[model samples]
Target: MAKKPKTAITPVRSDNYPEWYQQVIKAADLAENSSVRGCMVIKPWGYGIWENIRTHFDAIIKKRGVQNAYFPLLIPKSYLEKEAEHVDGFAKECAVVTHHRLEDDGAGGLKPAGELAEPFVIRPTSETIIGESFSNWVQSYRDLPLKINQWANVMRWEMRPRLFLRTSEFLWQEGHTVHATAECAATEASEMLEIYANFAENMLALPVIMGEKTPDERFPGAKHTYTIEAMMQDGKALQAGTSHDLGQNFAIASDIKFSNQDGHVVHAHTTSWGISTRLIGGIIMAHGDDDGMIVPPKVAAQQVVIIPAVHDEADREAIMEKCLGLKLVLETISFDNIMISAVIDDRDEVTSTKSWNWIKKGIPVRVEIGKREIEGNQVFFKRRDESPREKHIMPEDEFLGSIADILLSIQNNLLERAKSYRAQKMKKIDSLDEIFNYFKSEDAGFANIPHSLWDEGLSEKMKTDFSVSPRCLPIIDGELSDRLIIARSY
Candidate 1:
């Protein structure tokens, strides 16, 4: 038989950094540019990863008694004006629908596209609109704490969109809750922040630091904002998730209040938290390698890929039977061409090429079935991103049993690897000058600087002049350092 040449691919990290990132997204088949300039069409493979992440994170919110709901994509212009700061924060990036539709040229005559007197603005966040609903829903103390969550897409006009990192339009789940007292709202805000940290470290196998945002970094309508920041492979921090304590700003703006037991009319406190598809970007940046993407087992859509290699028809039939049988155990199973992979058993290509194919896709587990393994009544499996593939051999009957423990180990190992990197990357220092010095000296990773006073000038200056923003002003309780400001963010 004639031979086909192998396809050569460039390595990431050593390659141009941005180019490598572009290649990572493409090679992984996450998404690509659509007809629109900055918009992207998220392929199923990429959406599958998002589904895995959303499923687990959504479960966390549902477990806390937060009911799911949806709000309009476009909000009335007046709603944004309710909170002065919120409008200022999002005005520039707002995609305003000035005229819903324009008259078609004379060639086709004017088409009735649509009409609008006062065009609605696509929501950058649901705080304003959600606040309006809260005002209408709560008339008394009985409607004190109203917890609601919505899964939707939002738009932000970013100059340079990097797939999941900073896309023009992205998918995320936002939670808005109204509380009778500031204490209850604050508790809910902080609780969601912790939940985000837990999800990052455990499910996504990503390490993060939980804290409060600096003055300039606080959410537009929020009195206080909290976040979970994760450091990427390049040492840049990514704000993985955020929770904001709105206090009475939104409540007062929307006139949402309740009469207490003493007949005193009091404003409610509000909070909003969100974790977006941006997380998929973080996971790629944090856990991926030069070879390609590396997904943690818990959230990996395709946990295992089985490739059957048989010389005879009978052998192939038997192997196919075994592959079909394993479907009951795994939720997502794939048996298809590895998608342009330049490796095939029948084709004379290096086994390493085949290995790279699976690595690029970040499949958690790979099973290689061949005539030899079939004759031996066993299967040869390899764990993605794991070295020493020699340990993957098992009898067909006990294969699943033997590898169950290993799959878990891979999940745990990835989390620890990311956690240790974050701890090593964080800098705990004092003084404002020290923050800049640390960035210059240490490749500018996430800084855990402690500064006295949480004043606006100090924190706001860092944000505007420098790219650094505050992740959070963490709740220290008694151990809380005096007004110490943490400088650094995404």
Candidate 2:
């Protein structure tokens, strides 16, 4: 029998995908479980990716007339109680603060001491608290379209935590907007869903299916919820982002009333949309190989890493100089309107080790300069999107001029590869029996069925039998389609 090739990540994805995922994160030094259960400490590399995501997405929303704002972290318990459905939806996950301070116990440990008149809930989702502020901020039609976004951390007591995928605490950006009419609010929700889909595809190189959630899957207290779902390499769906059309539900709950042009006081229509750290996990699962992550160039923390291969002491200085010069030149070049970022791996380690380090970190480009390459005036490089063994050598001038194009190529390739994979895995099913049969396999992918066929009984049967649920009613072209996608998801 032919032997399996050795991979950097043991229990290669084909053998054990979940374990391989955890190993890839460890190898890349992205994040680690914290002492606090169900939480993570994102290392520099992981947080850097998030920063890039935030910076790019922030600019996109700002261009749409959305303003950045801050809201209180501790929300009054009464605020959640105001929206019964919303509170009930998140009741099990809410973490409440009942005491004001802690006092010393006889056992020499801290214990709850000063009780408060009213308890507070750590911000699970900012809808209620932000609605309270919106109620006071909007009093007339002039303040109809109040768009605001906040970058914050939220706590939801996850029963099963897995790093970025699901944790007790995670970082996210939540956007809330108030509009005069329900139609306008609905438009806002759909627009945000498109923005999320575009960002996932173009920036993160994650191809996603845009769709509307079924009634049972809609966000708590939302009139309608839209989502952008991406198919991971393992054929499971990941709901990357969501937008909710509140349709005056939150406004009525919080009393966000405003005087309309007709001189009548009425509750405002509202919308809420958000994306979170879970996206990092999606990227890893979608683009990562048996080796490690393959971050798209547009959102890569470092787009390029220049490694100096020094075999002898005499040639070290010249190679070092060339690597530094290349780093500076690469940084000056721009891709996707953002300046390229490059770093030199000059640590006292073997060249192969340094190269593999950057490869595991999923940097798009790795440029290596040794004594021979310096003398020949050439740059040898490898692309993360391609096999690690594949290398290309080009003249120094040619490499400098084409670095941006190379990065763009990597980004496009990753996106196309994922799109192709998902297309191959997706199947159109005619009956519930076929759906069950499809998922009986190990990696069943997405099953598309007519929306008319979906009913509460089928939903329950699918869930109970195969752990599958309706993903969405996919949006095709410019409109929502009758086709529904069902799958096991993260």
Candidate 3:
């Protein structure tokens, strides 16, 4: 077998997967750590990609009858206490505001003042708070179904924080809905899972396995939790998205009642589902190579970058003119119904420097125009997914005509590659000892553990013994089975 070429990134993926991840973020200029502990400053380039993901996913949920709304950021401590199990689940991670003002400490510093009668907890999740609104807004069968979505920032005190994966504060979209029937709520939850899976595959170019969380892993106060799990380049699983069927737990806790068709007041069934900025982390791990991130065309900040390979100062004018013209043409091409974003790197730096810089940023395609290419009426191109050492030449007209299709191909190819990698890593194991040994291997991936092996203590033991946990249990043929998808996770 031929050895893989060395990546431009130091401490490449093969050398250290975690460090390589940080390097990729740095090389791509995506984000950075902030002065506030456990938080990050998402740079413009990073936020642009996130904005694209947000805009695309927002349309998807809206099409499914969800309407945008906003709720308070601070939840009264009593509100969280209304739901016992929910409060217990998030108590440790909740950040509380004890005072309303700051006062002089009589020294050179200031101290908290104006102590509040009731502390307000920064929302870890908004189910309880949203439930309060639902209880007040719901009055009759006419208002039985209420679906609201919020794009907001949430905070959870994390002991160990990574840039995008486990930040103290991050942005996300949460969808909450009320239904007249439990069956309808379940169906809504399932539908959202499908929507999330589709978006992950089609837009993010990530292949995910849709499944249900075990009772032990289900969201607190939720009847059931459904998730889309994807395997990353390092063979670890990442929980990409999740939807929860809250049943009547939240409705009952918040006193949300509505008149039924039969003329009796009944508690409404509710569901809450969300996808967060952690998705950015998933994208980085799932598709990024040792060189840097390979953003799918649908979610890339910039899909194409044109570089003028000016070998002679006398020819710089012509080379730059051609590059700018090609940029104009490429930007007009649309892929997946989104206009292509292209930019020309007409920097005064060396041609190799410009080419390598955009390569590190993982632009889907890079086109080089020079005097020779102009004379030949052709252009040189390179794909981010392929080795940077390799380049291809094609007629200018053909390249322009096929640009959209080429991007679509790259999107499809990334999804297929992730699917293939996951397929290679998964296996079925029946015996407990075999399951344990499977995870102990150096290159361990995912294992299908029998349902009978699960217990309340399993999660802790797996974390201690193997640094692995159950990702989800597969839902097959409209039923959830005893088989479990277990693997190490981010």
Per-candidate TM-scores read 0.87, 0.98, 0.96
Stretches of model 2 off by over 4 angstroms after superposition? 1-5
Instruction: Point to the candidate with the largest TM-score.
Output: 2
Evaluated against the true structure, the overall lDDT of model 2 is 0.93
> Could you give candidate 2's per-residue lDDT for residues 27-126 as a string of tens digits?
9999999999999999998998999999999999999999999999999999999988898899899899999998888898999999989999999999
Better of 1 and 3 by lDDT: 3
Clashing pairs in 1: 211-472, 212-471, 212-472, 212-473, 213-472, 451-484, 451-485
Q: Write the per-residue lDDT of candidate 3 for residues 453-490, one digit (tens) a residue.
A: 87767768888989888889888766788899999988
lDDT of every model, 2 decimals = 0.74, 0.93, 0.90
Could you tell me the lDDT of residue 197 within candidate 2?
A: 97
The predicted structure with the larger TM-score, 1 or 3, is 3
Candidate 3: TM-score? 0.96
Rank list by lDDT: 2, 3, 1
Residue 158 in candidate 2, Cα distance off native in Å:
0.6
Write one digit per residue (lDDT tens) for candidate 1, span 278-334: 998898888877767777777776677766665566776776666655545443322
Count clashes in each candidate, considering only residues at least 3 apart in sequence or on different chains: 7, 0, 0
Decide which is better by TM-score, 2 or 3.
2
RMSD of 2: 1.9
